[model samples]
Target chain A: MTMNKLQKSERFSVVKKILIIITSLFAGFATGVFGGGGGMIIVPILTGLYGLQQTKAHATAIATIFPLCLVSVIFYLTHGGWEWKSGLVVTAGVVVGGIVGALAMKKIPAKWLQPIFYILMIVGGIKMLAQ
Target chain B: MQYLWYIIAGLIGGVIGGMGMGGGTLLIPILTIFLGVEQVEAQLTNLISFLPMAIVAVIIHAKNKRIDFKAMLWVSVPALVTACVGAYFAPRVKSEWLSKGFGAFLTLLGVAMIIKIIVQKIKSKRRANK
Candidate 1:
């Protein structure tokens, strides 16, 4: 039974694999272009297409974005448009806050956070557009 | 004084980003709109700052066994190759357009997320009633 199940799972068609790759490439392009869309793109594809669990999708998206972000950084740096000093300062805060936030996720359920995040995004977006 | 703002922006963006949503969505706006940084500069800064935050978050999530390593392989390579493609075009785009585009993108993302949650809630409710 286990072997049969494994075989069944392994039988993803070439079309399916190609679709996944295409979706992933689009997600990466969005991430590179927006500098922030990786999770927004990857999580949905993982959950909707691959049927991964929500938490697992979120975690996996982060793992995937890590290398993609690194690659994007190389191009951004070579292009000479960034301020290293400001970037470093922000990074210091981001690193510390990231660890704290990750730990905090264990304490709070994601459902509770989603509404607030959406509201924040809307407000931030409106503020940007208004300016 | 300005450094303080940068740190604060980073910290907030980091926390949110570490939560599994991209920080650049929030960080870039905070830097560009609020802190008065240029669009390209803010974007670059966001990308740069994002690296460390993502790395740190991944570490924490991995420790908790939240990550599905197998699924990661499918996205990583394709994403890695295309990310540079996007970055290459970023600077060439006009700043005004970039700002407007980012704003529109964020608004759409917010709307989509809200709709998704509402749909999920209704579906779960129907399931429970059934």
Candidate 2:
């Protein structure tokens, strides 16, 4: 990339930054409120508005959600809503599944992934709402 | 066969989690709605399960240079703070209301995405014509 183009791309607009932070905050809030789904929101903002590549956006969204998840977990533990045994079992699945999924990211094209994500979100949202 | 479900659930959730889409969204519903786990327990399980997956995915992404650490830092601070606040306020809301609202939000996003696709197609078609 040319220096001018690189600089232009890297330059963070104040408006954009604020928008990102605000969205991030809301995503975090959603995670806390729903105890999940923050990444759903974060990934979109990163990919759509922040202009991150799809793969990077997916990875970054996970990274961004880490701290928020930790915070909420603390509350879940203290506030008396956890089932450790079941959580342990699920954790085992996620650990293995997560690694595989991350590797799988390389195989999928961005065009396909975005729609898959949207479909998952729509399906998940509907299921939760119906329940 | 009974414990198989947990492993299967974890594996699926882990894969999705690694994809950065939040496995809990998938895992929780599967556990609660299908597997007969209680809602709160399912939610908590999702949270715990994501921890290790997140760590693994992030580390891999980091090595691949896929993560923008600067943006991660910028988003994390407020997210961390608000997450706590959201958790604090969560108990006040009725579970039914919460589910309904979350459901509505997801549907809205889905609709928005379809609109986005249409808009982009129109813009490209215009460009092509010129």
Candidate 3:
């Protein structure tokens, strides 16, 4: 999905590009295997490795995850996976909430994003491990 | 009626996810922990559900001119290949072990992120003091 040439003319060396690819491999597989966390991996790569700003990085993350998640959904659906009774309900709510949340991002201060995110990661991590 | 909780679960997870924090990260755990779903099933739900939410979010972001399709290609092409491999193998793994492995991954990443935040905060404070 090539969009208009990136607004800026910045480019990365082959080595850096390769690093992006390798890390994406991790992001892609994580989403496929775990069914989530691709965005977490992808966003850091955009912001840290690629040096995109917060909003752009989040946008690009969705762009990247859209395709990655599509691949996983295909495989999961094909392989004896039809648990959508509850899944549909959740998906429906996610769509409505997603719209508002995406809108809300622009209003939020980026300075606070990292601290909040790290806290979320720690909390989610402990919960998963505890279970 | 019974699904009301599920709806609420999705809503909370979606909002955070929309903020670009990885919806499935929270969503899968929510399903597994609070709603009593199996680990694998929760993962599957997260994956399937993500498709629609991402589409919606992407469109909204696109309209806002937020997405970098160039980056999308750079990262996604290679990721697409391995995603197939991972997806192919995921179902074959034992669910409990898989959950535990993912749990460890989250915990490690969490610890690392917190450490990074602390260091950043300290660095800023030191700069302020100077």
Candidate 4:
């Protein structure tokens, strides 16, 4: 695919940098505590705030969240969450499936799925909140 | 049987995550609510599982040259500092509180996503009409 040519400035403004830092801090903290979901925060920051396109923002969001997950997982391992059996199983599945999803994302009509996703999340959230 | 469920949950979450939405948001709740995994353990699983997926994704994105590396660096640095601190404190927080907080987070995100999608749909329809 040819690039969209939204070529952002190579230079960063102090204001922009500060905003990025502040939001990143929030994303990182939430990821650490919640153990996942940093991408949600980072994607919008990349797209709406930084002017990247949807696909580019998604890719960059992945790159941004990787280190945060790595760091948080280490702390998790240190702090009594170290059950190798199940974690490894999940990891195996995730590794296999993540690659597939990453490849298929370009082909899928993601717009149709968004509504379902949000509804599911809302139902799941209500259940958890009640429980 | 349980292992199958574990893999299924992981697969579903991974696929969604690889699609760019946060897999952990869905995975954590699935594990805790459906699989009867404890809250902290569910969180841990999400964190561990995402790493490998992220590695693969980064490689793919790198190959496509989609990532903005400079942006990645700037965003990651500050996030790294606070993530470390947050991780350090995570296990110390009560599981109940953590679970509740996550529930709130998920609900808020869901609401926001719905609004965003609606706005997008309206805007797209308007564009098409024009």
**TM-score for chain A as predicted in candidate 1:** 0.77
Clashes of each: 0, 8, 0, 0
Which ranking of candidates, highest lDDT first? 4, 1, 3, 2
Candidate 2 local lDDT, B2-61, one digit each (tens): 568888988877776666555677776677656777655666688777777677767877
Residue B25's C-alpha lDDT in candidate 3?
Answer: 76
Query: What is the fraction of true interface contacts found in candidate 4?
Result: 0.79
TM-score ranking, best first: 4, 1, 3, 2
Candidate 3 regions off by >4 Å?
A1-12, A103-127, B123-130
Can you give the lDDT of residue B128 in candidate 2? 100
Q: Which parts of model 1 have CA positions greater than 4 angstroms off?
A: A1-18, B60-66
lDDT of 4 by residue, A76-113 (tens): 88878477798788878887778888788789966687
User: Model 3 — interface RMS deviation?
Assistant: 2.0
How would you encode candidate 2's per-residue C-alpha lDDT over A14-83 as one tens digit per residue? 6778888899888888888777888878887888767798778878888898888888878877777566
Kindly list the per-residue Cα lDDT of model 3 for residues B3-70, writing each as its tens digit: 99889888877877777666667777777778888877888888877887767667888999998888
* Residue B90 lDDT, candidate 4, scale 0-100: 82
Candidate 1, residues A1-131, lDDT tens digits: the string is 99998777677655567888999998888778777767787888889877799888887887888887787777777777567788899989888878777788789766687789888889988877776
Provide the lDDT at B91 for model 3. 77
Tens digit per residue, CA lDDT, model 3, A1-131: 24433423334455678799999998888878887787777888898777789789988888887777777878877876667788899888887777777788789844577567666656766777676
TM-score of each: 0.87, 0.80, 0.84, 0.90
Candidate 4 interface RMSD value = 1.3
| Candidate 2 local Cα displacement, residue A3, angstroms | 21
Candidate achieving the largest TM-score: 4
Window of ten residues with lowest summed lDDT in model 1 chain B:
B48-57
lDDT of each: 0.81, 0.76, 0.78, 0.83
Superposed model 2: Cα runs more than 4 Å off: A1-12, A108-117, B113-130
In terms of docking quality, how is candidate 1 classified? medium
